[model samples]
Target: MDCLTSKVQISQFLDNELPQELLQPLFYHLGECEECRNFFVRTKVVHEGAKNVEYAAVPKELDEKFAVLEMGEKNVSLMNRKFTISVPTAIYSIGAVIVMVLFIYVSGTIQEKQIAEQYRQTMNLTMPFSEISYDRN
Candidate 1:
């Protein structure tokens, strides 16, 4: 087995959770790989040390504050909520924005076409006849 797999198995072994089938392979790998063996030893030491350490109890004042916060959170009901948007309202809002954008775009396009036509008409009226060409080739 690889060192990575062996290290994970080592942790599982210390926790007494390694599968029976894997135990022999992990032991064999640990016996051969010095680096993984050292890692396993260090992890075992830390795990044992953690088990021996004592946990302190929470202070009464802090516990009381947390209890008050929990009560406050639980007291607020779903019906007491103020603001919410329905699906139809959101759909209508999106549709209105799309319509407005299309209106503006179409109006701008029509205005540009009208301006171009007017410019062509003005040029036809102002240019001399000699400059006009009637070639069809």
Candidate 2:
């Protein structure tokens, strides 16, 4: 198997879950390539480290917080209501949209004027050259 394919199967190979056909080729590639060997070593070290590490115990404070929150939830009533847009909020939203549209329009007009100026300058520079070419032809 190629190095790329073998790299993908490395974890599965360590766990003895890789297919039999790929096993020998992967081992051969790992032995021949120094980079792959180093990668394999790092992966193996990480795997072993993870396996030997102990999980921490949960804090007692978390249980107390949950108990207080459950008590609060029991005293609260769940409310279901339809959403409505207030007139002031709707007016502010419309004003924001209009400001954005005006900004875009002004910016676009400025860009268009700049592009036109550039085109005129290019034409002015090439006018003499065009006359010379026309005379030669």
**Which candidate number maximizes lDDT?**
1
Error of 2 at 95 (Å): 98
Identify the candidate with maximal TM-score: 1
Which digits, one per residue and each the tens of the lDDT, describe model 1 over residues 16-109? 9999999888889989999999999899999999999998998998998889777876677544767889999999999999999999999999
Screening candidate 1 with a backbone cut-off below 3 angstroms (N, C-alpha, C), the clashing residue pairs are none
Score each candidate by Cα lDDT.
0.88, 0.82
Q: Write down the worst ten-residue block by lDDT for model 2.
A: 126-135
| Backbone collisions counted per model | 0, 0
CA displacement after TM-score superposition, residue 116 of candidate 2 (Å): 99
TM-score of each: 0.43, 0.42
Cα-lDDT of candidate 2? 0.82
Q: 31-111 in candidate 2: lDDT tens per residue?
A: 898878888999999988989899898799988878988777666634444478999999999999999999999999999
